[model samples]
Target: MPRADRFLSIRRDPLSDEVLARGGDPEAHSLLQRTGFVPVARAHETYHRVPTNLAERDEARLATEAVGRLRSAGYHVDCEGDFDTDHRPVHYLPLGASVAHIAERIREATTTDEVADALTDLTAAHDGVLAAVDEVLVALADFHEGLGDTADPHIARRLRYLAEERLGVITSDLSHTRNALADRHAPHPGRSTCTEQVPSNERERSAVCACPPPPRTLPAPPPPPVAAAMRR
Candidate 1:
C-alpha cells in the first residue's frame, strides 16, 4: 500500500465551517466513519465531515476521537489543536476481518479439502457469513418498509433484490464448488505438502525440510513492449 494512504488530516473547512477529514485510504475512511463522520463523495475526491447541526464542541470531540482511533491503527493524522491528543483508543477487530480471514485461508490452501473448509465458513447453511448478511439485508428491508419516506418502498425493494438475487448467486456457486471439492479428496498437482523431514542422503545434518522452494509469482512480463508502428 502507498505511504500516503496512512496519512490524513482533520480540520474545519473554512468555507463550510464544517469539521472535515481529508486524505487516507478506505480502511482509514471506515475508521473515521465509525467515529461519527459522514462520507462525502465527489467527482475528484472523497472526504468525511462531522454530521451537520452538531454543536461545535461535539464536532471537536468527534474529531478528537477519530484522531485517537486512527493513531491506534497506525495512521498519522494531522488535526487542529483541539483535536490533537496523546490518547490512543482501543479498537477490536471488525466483523469484516473474520470474513477476510477466509480468503487468506483459501490463498494458502494446497489441497481440495483445505479450500473446502474455508468455503464452509461462507456457505454453511446454519450461520455462515453469507447467511448472516442475507439476514441483515432482510432486516434492513423490513425497516425501510415502514420508514414513511416517499422512496422508502423502492429502497426496500432494491435491498430485497440484492439479498435474494445477487447474493443468492454467489452463495449458490460457492456452495457447489465447496461440495465438489469435498468429494474430490485431491491435492493441488502444482503444489506439494511439506514433509518437514531430512533426506537420508542429506549433506546438511541440520536440514529440517527437503521440499523444493515454492515458485515465485512473477507478474505477466510487461505487455510484450508494444512495438512502434513501422515508418510508413
Candidate 2:
C-alpha cells in the first residue's frame, strides 16, 4: 500500500480566502515552508498556510512552486487548476537527513563505544549539530533585534532564552551520556557482537566464527475478528 505521506493537496479555503496545504509528511512540509508557507499545528493535524496579505498572484506562484517541488520529489499533489504545473524541480538530500542518520547508526550499534561514536556527531563541542543549532538561534535573535515590529525585541529575547536554557540542558545531558558510553566498553545485552574468530576447540575446521546464527523474524498475528453484534 502507498504511504500516507506520499500524497498532499494545496488549495485556498473558500470561506477564509487563505491558501492552505494539507496531507503531507515532514519532507513535504519542509518543501512548503521553503516555498513561503507558514505551518499551523492543530490538535488533530498540522497544515501550512500562505502568509496573510500576500498578493493573490504571489500566493498562486508560491503554491504552484511547492506543488512542482513536491511532484519532482515523487509526491502526488492534488492542487487547484491555477497551481497545477508540469515543472519538477531537482530535489537534493536535506541537511536534517544527515542528523537523522546518526540515530540510524545508534539503532544499528551493538556496543557502547559505537553508540557513543555516533552521538559524537551531535554532542561535539566545536562543530556538532547542537552547536550549529545554537549558532542558528543566536543568528535569528540578531535578525529580530533590528526588526521594527513591536514584539521583535521580545521574540529576540525568547530565542536567546531557548538557546541558553532548553538547548543548553539537552546539549549538557547528551554530552555527559556520550562520555559515559565512551568509557563503558560494554556491548548491548540484546544484541550479538561477532568477533569473527573461530574457536580453537571447534570440531569443524572450516567454521568461520563462534557466533550463533541470527534469530528468525516472525510475522505478526492478525487482529481478532469483530463479533456480528459489534459490527451491527
Candidate 3:
C-alpha cells in the first residue's frame, strides 16, 4: 500500500515551532524533534511479551499475515479473527529469534561477560516493556529511561514499527466503535460526534434503534513489508 493511504499522519514527527523558527527540517540529532518512542516502547513490550494481546483488530490480523516463517516452513494458517466463537488468543514467543539476535550481538560485544549481560538486558527490557504496557503504563516510564542511544538499531526500529502499527489499529478501532456507539446512543445530549444520527420514535426507542450507525468493517491489514522483517 502507498504510504499515504496506509497511514494518516502527515509525518511521524513534524518540526516543532522552536525548531521551525531556527531553520528548516531539524537535524538528525535534534532533541526538539517529536518521536513516538515512549508509546512505541510500550507497544513493543506488548507484542514481544504477548503477541496475541494486541488490542486492535487490524493489527492482530496483520501480524498473523506477516509471519513469513510460519508460512514458508509449513504449518502456516491464519484463522481470520473468529476468536469470539472459535478460539482464545495466545502469545507464542520466538525464542529462537531472540537467541539468534543475542548471539550476533555477543559476537560484536567486547567480552563474554558483556555478551551475557547484553543478552540478559535485552530479554529483561523486552519483558519490562510488555509488563508495563499491559499491566502498568506508568511503570514502563522507568524502563524507558534505562534505554539509551546504545541498543541495536534493528531492535529499536522493530519495536518502534510495532508500536506505531498498534497505535494506528487501536486509534482506528476506537474511532470506528465510538462512532457506532454515538449514532445509536446519545451522550449527555447535544454532545458532538462525527457519527451520523439515525431516526427513531421516542416511544419506540426501546424497541427501535435510534441513530443506528453502519456496521463496522475494519480495514484489511496491509501486507508485510518483507519476509525477514515480518518474522516475529
Backbone clashes for every candidate come to 0, 0, 3
What order do candidates take by TM-score, descending? 2, 1, 3
Question: Model 1, range 72-175, lDDT digits (tens) per residue?
Answer: 99999999999999998898888789999999998889999999999999999889999999999999999999999999999999999999999999999999
Estimated TM-score per prediction? 0.81, 0.83, 0.19
What's model 2's TM-score? 0.83
lDDT for 105 in candidate 3 is 67
- The regions of model 2 sitting more than 4 angstroms off are 1-4, 195-197, 201-209, 212-232
Ranking by lDDT: 2, 1, 3
Which consecutive 10 residues in model 3 have the weakest lDDT in total? 17-26
Per-residue lDDT of candidate 2, residues 48-68 (tens digit): 999988899999999999999
Residue-level lDDT for 229 in candidate 2: 75
Number of the predicted model whose TM-score against the real structure is largest: 2
lDDT of 3 by residue, 155-183 (tens): 55555555556644654554454445435
Model 3: lDDT equals: 0.36
